[model samples]
Target: MISEPDLVKYLPDCQFGVNSATRLRFDFRNSGSGERVRAPWYRPLCRQDFLRPRTAAMEYPLGRHNFLRSNNLEEMQDVLGRIMCPHRLSYLDKPEPLDAVINSFDLGNLVLNYVQYGVPIAVDPGATGDFYALQIPLYGNALVRSGGKTIISTPEIMAVTDPEAPLYMELERSTKLLLVRADWDFANRVLRDLTGGLLPWKLRFDLGLDVSAGRQCQWFTEVVNLVRRADVGGGMLKGPMWVPQLEESMVARLIQLHAHRYSELLATPAMPASQRVFGQVVDKIEAMPEQLHTEGSLASEFDVSSRSLRSAFQRYLETSLFGKLWHVRLHRAHLDLLWATPEETTVPAVAERWGLWEPLFTQRYGENYGETPEQTLRR
Candidate 1:
């Protein structure tokens, strides 16, 4: 079990305890309420042991099963926190049950885990919503099927499926897997923004889970080690404020690495005209940062009504086109302040270069960057 001092150090506002021999619980609460808003854990016993609603039991896999459950309406929030909370699992829920174990973490935006098993288990997709599930086998072979298309991932193979779409998994013998469940909103938002909101469904990438032999695998193992040590409190706990960003970055890197391996997943069809137009406008603003123009001018240039331009930006970028353009311009100006030579930079000059001629620009810059442009220049 993780030590009390370490738990306190790493997860200051959370409660951690072991209930009976098979249940582990961690309660996460905000600083003010002191009431746990989320409880996420691993359960080794039969599904029938937990007196949950019959509806919950109905969702279990057919025949015998071992699973984990989180008792919180804000389950996503809780799970993400716990996984990324920098704590460790002291004991396996089952002894010699299978070398395979399910390890979960809450990294604020995503909940991720690694499952190792001595015996194979069948998995079926859930009904109701479209979610994202990525499964990568570390040892042995496995078969994953989605929408009648079957993909086989050998030892060190990975595959992805859209939870909104039906899928099935059949493992050859017992195998180990790294499974991740991410918030649909967060995942969709990130991918859509990165892809300019062009793809229809969430993006899925298949990584051949072969980290055991290469630098990629070495990096993966090292990250897992760091996360485990943090969870167990092997003297690596920083404050809570830093945990969320670190966790998010880790998950993002994983997504990026895996996506690089499966670039085909991103090769969907062309984006809609709205997104294309919005992208064009963004490009223009980025290229001509000194041109302080109103949305009306941009709309005129695009030959579309201002209302249409606004609507297009909202749909594609989830923000007004003008707002994004302003943000980009400011971001560029800030970058210049940070990296440009002193002789080539000045607060007022930077502002003018980015078309921030109004007093409000200073306020917005400070709000966004946590420092005024003058302060940045001084730095």
Candidate 2:
């Protein structure tokens, strides 16, 4: 891989420089026309039509990731602004010059944001919020002044914003950032399980997570890479099944990697009754894979709220209520196929017995078993 410095020599046609070791300054002007042209951000899948929502599945193929491309500041208020809480986005240098594009993907408990204003900009919000935000600069740096601490977020070091702090962020004109926003309630639930109950103190992190080296970089890189891969266009990426696993992994990795006040307690968290219930629930599913199980059904049987039950599964099992059930059902189908009477059973019959059908059944079966049900039966 080429070092960041050698970029200038390799890219002779473009102007590039590092300002303050934070700003990745690059200016590319249109040669044919005297107007400025923004670089491409969205993949070819949705790049063809910016008007269409990238999340729509049937209307277009694999609306892989949500995308927004606009020069309008007011428009961002409705899209990025809403999710980020009440905030004001403004151009720092010029009032009218703005080329902002944002792509956000949801992972149940957390959200991954890829944002770029393509101009010097500031995001202003209230004094306190209910989420933890980890900002990593992919292209350029951003200065984060939050909770009475000022941190310059670069590629090597990430800036962490806790829920208790007010947030003010300014990005240089040449910057693209990836931010992971973890919801307060969801985070608390995970932490609570780790500590057996909500501690008297709130979860807080140091202003910066030094990902320049060590385990911090490894974990952060792993989570970010997973997000990038998940954002790719595909039928499976759109499935509801993968969400819980993604959420659990994101929260778990952040908890394990990031330096926080509860690091000691979280490191050796106690397993509670709820965790036992989650395990027992797993056993129940395996014992009777043929039974139809839903979150509400499982929660009722276990004497816990559906939300708590979900949390238990997400925290301890790293999967959802339905996700585990689906896995068990798939496993049962495979077993049936493995010992099938070739003359008496068909792929469709085996699949149907386990509430599976069609090409999707074949697809899911192949993915889970490394072969089609037909192949398993043939053997």
Candidate 3:
């Protein structure tokens, strides 16, 4: 007798956007205020889902860059430790030949990874490190243990892990995962800025993603895909300009949309900053966007603390100081793109003039005006 294909068994070939590979890994919705859901690790897939023949010899793209064709557990562990994170990989089943793949991208303080394993395994990251992680399962599922809590990470639900804690996971034979990591400082700053300096305590996210209505998962996915597309086209990751903007937007969105210890505080309406403080920072950003304009430098320039400056930007502009600077540079680049002649100006040249790269410029332009720099130049 044949059984129906469970959700994990089959993936549509044409779903991901990149020519190589890009797919949403986590979409786990919170169960309830205090409810915990445990999903099974193993789900049988239909034979038709096999790419070639589901034989002992098969290769899968790691993420977007690497591939795993060999089943050697040591090689897999070594590659993972070097490229993504360090962990102990152990087979749960009878070590019946392993097959796996991994792909990763680093953007500013945020790291994204896509991984899949063909055999049941146990993963124990002794300590998660100084970064927060959100693990989403694209195909199949896994059981994650962290902070004395066990949560099922599946397609409809994601696991949120605290960086200061240790975590363990049990993977199914066909488990594929998408993981997002944010630096502690980056995440902390985003929360503080978003709340207009009213965050009086540490911020902690719930173990599960808040997929409940109005979550910013869709927005986060768009940003992730946009970066992937730019990288695939080439030349975007060459500079630091566009990366920080994308990273800040991504982090800020996560804080605003997800359910966490500070969710209620973030949702509280923020008080506006004083006009005097706002004007001072805007002047500095407009006058010298190309300068090493960190919050510390800007605060020192205007005789204000970094916290004060962040609050001013958050309260008045609803963005970080760097975010405003990004906008200023972006606008200048847009004008230059319009004035540039195709014979003398290239996308890279124009982008470099504003500290951005060609691919980023193209992506940003398309996003803002629904046209690319090349298209804009043609007209």
Ranking of all predicted structures according to lDDT, beginning with the best and ending with the worst: 2, 3, 1
Candidate 1 per-residue lDDT over residues 160-206, each given as its tens digit: 56545566666644455556655655555444433343455555544
lDDT of 3 by residue, 104-210 (tens): 67675877776766689998876677777778776688998887788988765778787777889999975777677778877787665554444566666777773
Give lDDT for model 1. Answer: 0.48
Instruction: List all candidate RMSDs to the true structure.
Output: 17.4, 10.7, 11.2
Higher-lDDT candidate of 2 and 3: 2
C-alpha lDDT score of every prediction, in listed order: 0.48, 0.62, 0.60
Worst 10 residues of 3 by lDDT: 1-10
After superposition of all CA atoms, the RMSD between model 2 and the true structure is 10.7
| lDDT of prediction 2 | 0.62
lDDT of 3: 0.60
The parts of candidate 1 lying over 4 Å away from their true place are 1-100, 127-130, 193-201, 206-227, 234-239, 254-379
Best by lDDT: 2
Candidate 1: TM-score?
0.39
Candidate 2 local lDDT, 156-194, one digit each (tens): 778888787788999998777777778887766555544
